[model samples]
Target: MRVSVDTDRCCSSGQCVAAVPEVFDQDEDEGLVLLLDAEPPVQRQASVRLAAGICPGRAITIHEE
Candidate 1:
């Protein structure tokens, strides 16, 4: 699974970070979504997907390969 975040569309809600801190974070200064792991392990896929789905700005994207 691959995860990507569009910072431009982020609202700094931190939902992604809250959902999966292992794969996502929020910039302290900019308050934008940060992609910690572009390619997270399979074990983290469910959390990643949840984060993406709950993102208020719809800034998260996921790809499975």
Candidate 2:
């Protein structure tokens, strides 16, 4: 799976980071979403999907490429 995010739509809520620290993080100043790993390890798949689902703005997008 591949992960993508629209920065303009992100609110930096940190939900993604909280759910999947291995795949997501926040910027220091803007507190925006940042992908710590574009393609996270398999063990983190469920959390990554959960993060995408919990994003308030629907900014996170995932692809099975």
Winning model by lDDT: 1
Runs in model 2 with CA error above 4 Å?
Answer: none
The 10 consecutive residues of candidate 2 with the worst lDDT sum are 33-42
Cα deviation of 11 in candidate 1 (Å)?
0.3
Per-residue alpha-carbon lDDT of model 2 for 1-65, expressed as tens digits?
99988888999899998999888889999999988888877898888999999999888898987
Off by over 4 Å in 1: none
TM-scores for every predicted model: 0.95, 0.93
Clashes of each: 0, 0
The TM-score that candidate 2 achieves is 0.93
The lDDT for every candidate, in the order shown, is 0.91, 0.89
Worst 10 residues of 1 by lDDT: 1-10
- lDDT for model 2, please: 0.89
Q: How far does residue 47 in candidate 1 sit from its true spot (Å)? A: 0.4
Q: Each prediction's Cα RMSD?
A: 0.6, 0.8
